[model samples]
Target: MDHVILFEGIPMSKSMRGMCKEEDYAFLGEKGKHHKETDTLGEDWKEEKMERERRRRERAQQEQERIRELEESRKEKEQQWRHHVSELASTQEQRLRDRLARIHHFRDFQRKVLVEEMSLQTDSESSQALDQLLTRI
Candidate 1:
């Protein structure tokens, strides 16, 4: 008979029956506007989600870089400490060697003095013995 059928919110039956009025076109345009609004809302939600993910990734990357810098700094400090310790050890070793050499030199000087004193005592004894023997003759 003359029934009106809606196709995507637009009347398609009666062959240009209800669609001939400007009011009908305006009403159908409102339906399309609602669809566009829904599509834009979904797009905005997706964009916001993507932006949040990007910011999170950037923060994670910055944290990783900071950790790497800290590790490198620790390694550098450790290396410097080792170098400083080695230098101190070397200095101490040299000081110990010098002290030992001084002790040895003092001991040698004392031995030489003792040898000279013994020789002087023996020479005096020999001279007194000859004098006694000459007086008796």
Candidate 2:
């Protein structure tokens, strides 16, 4: 008598070549041990594949998040650097203006002193030198 094999509630036999491959026949062994072991191995392989895919997706997401954070930090630093440079330039300009104002005041004071001294002295040589120096300044 010929034994009938069942796969997914359907009868399978060696003559049914279209229904299963030759390797499917290897699942038949003493006490159905071969089929059970094959089923267990298949389930384990699928589970392992799914786990690996999950871990890969998680790692990719983490990398993207890290890159986004780095970009934000870079922009923030750039903005801060620009602000610092602007402040430094403003302060330097103010100091330059102050120095120019003081120089102008000193020049005016020297001119007043020269005028008063020339009125009291008839020394023409020193008067000419002082006038030349004031003109140079």
Candidate 3:
């Protein structure tokens, strides 16, 4: 006898005859076009994708906000530095003007004193010459 055999009503290939039992023969119905039905997961998959996109957008927005805050802080610091520099320059200019005014005043006073001393010396010399001429006569 052969190692594989089929029953009278069961229609199966000779190769699969050894793998199936006599009881499995009753389960096989009429065979026609055997198309496998795939499952639909539209709602579940769509919600998952949307959730991931939302998280990504939130992270990007947070990063942009952090950069904006840093820029604002930098601008504020720069403005403060500019104000400090202008104040310092104005104060230094005022001090320089005060020093120049004092120097001018002192120079004018020295000139007046020198002119008065020269006039006094010339008057004394003329008086001495007249006194010498009278003695000789």
Candidate 4:
């Protein structure tokens, strides 16, 4: 007696060239038994997959746009801060130069006063010497 296998109501003999059609065969086990097909996903599985992929892409795009905006804002803020710091440095340098100029002016005034005092003392000593010489004569 010849043994026969039936899959999806189709009879398959041992010596048959093509035992089962590709679409009708679900999964072939080690024992050569074909597993029955089941509904792993509902009828709306394709639509659900499409919707999920669309939402994911949208979220990724939004995140990228937000990062770009943040970078631009950060660059602008950094430029403004640099400008502010430069202005402060320039103002401080100008103030320092003005202070140094004032110190120089005060030093020049003190030197002029010392020279005048020395000249007056020398003139008075010479006049006293001339008077003593005249009295001796």
Candidate 5:
């Protein structure tokens, strides 16, 4: 009697040629064990590949989130710095305006007192000096 092999639900015989490659045959002590092991190994390999891919995608997402947080932080710092600089500039401007106003008031008060204390004809040069100083200021 001739022995026949069933491979994946298909009958195969020794006389068959070009139907399957020689590498597809396994000659171990246990029949069909090599094919079953090959099938299980393929399943395991697919599972491992999918798991690694999942991990890689998760890492990429986490990195993107971290980058977004850093960008927001950097923008916040820049905004704070701009606000601080503007406040300082406003304070300095107000102080300068106050100083200018005080100087103008003092000059006017001095002019009035000097005019009342001296004769205009003899104190013309003094009056001119006061005018020049006020203009220069």
Candidate 6:
């Protein structure tokens, strides 16, 4: 680069020497110009393009992973809720059965007491009638 010459204050090609010949160049500092990959300014544009593309692909992959995690979490919560609802239903059913059993027991006890009271009343009325009959005789 330091050995490059200038023609009329315009930057020119390198001098014909060990690395190149005068017939090998078409313009100053240029090979036969049909867009070679090596002649980009500052940095290689292909590498930059590839880097941006890679970043886009990585972001897409990460987004898919996040969606999958959210889906799994939603399913897990739904399953837990279903189990909780089942437990509540079972508990309600048990309570209803117990209440019905208590009502049946109370009805049986009431019927037995009523039967005993009726029997005692019948015996007392018979004794009173017999005493009156004996006194008259």
In order, the Cα lDDT scores of the candidates are: 0.71, 0.78, 0.64, 0.65, 0.75, 0.65
- On TM-score, the leading prediction is 2
Q: lDDT score, residue 102, model 5?
A: 100
Candidate 2 — which pairs collide?
A: none
lDDT of 6 by residue, 1-137 (tens): 31144222344455524356433443655533434644573257777888999999999999999999999999999999999999999999999999999977865565455446544354666546544543464
Q: Write down the worst ten-residue block by lDDT for model 4.
A: 29-38
TM-score of each: 0.59, 0.65, 0.45, 0.53, 0.62, 0.54
Candidate 4 C-alpha error for residue 112, in Å: 3.8
Candidates 1 and 4: which is better by TM-score? 1
| Candidate with better lDDT, 2 vs 6 | 2
Q: State candidate 5's TM-score.
A: 0.62
| lDDT score, candidate 4, position 83 | 100
- Candidate 4 per-residue lDDT, tens place, 1-137, comes to 01123343455575562755543443332223321223335436777888999999999999999999999999999999999999999999999999999988965665456546545354666546544543464
Q: What is the lDDT of candidate 4?
A: 0.65
The better-scoring model by TM-score among 1 and 5 is 5
Q: Report the CA-based lDDT of candidate 6 relative to the real structure.
A: 0.65
lDDT of candidate 1 over 34-111, digit per residue (tens):
888889999999999999999999999999999999999999999999999999999999999999999889766754
User: Every model's Cα RMSD, please?
Assistant: 13.4, 6.3, 14.5, 12.0, 5.4, 13.2
Candidate 5 ranges with C-alpha deviation above 4 Å: 1-31, 112-126, 132-137
- Residue 94, model 1: Cα distance from true site in angstroms: 0.9
Off by over 4 Å in 2: 1-32, 120-132
| Per-residue lDDT of 51 in model 1 | 100
State the displacement of the C-alpha of residue 88, model 4, in Å, after optimal TM-score superposition.
2.2
Tell me which residue pairs clash in candidate 3. none
Better TM-score candidate (3, 4): 4
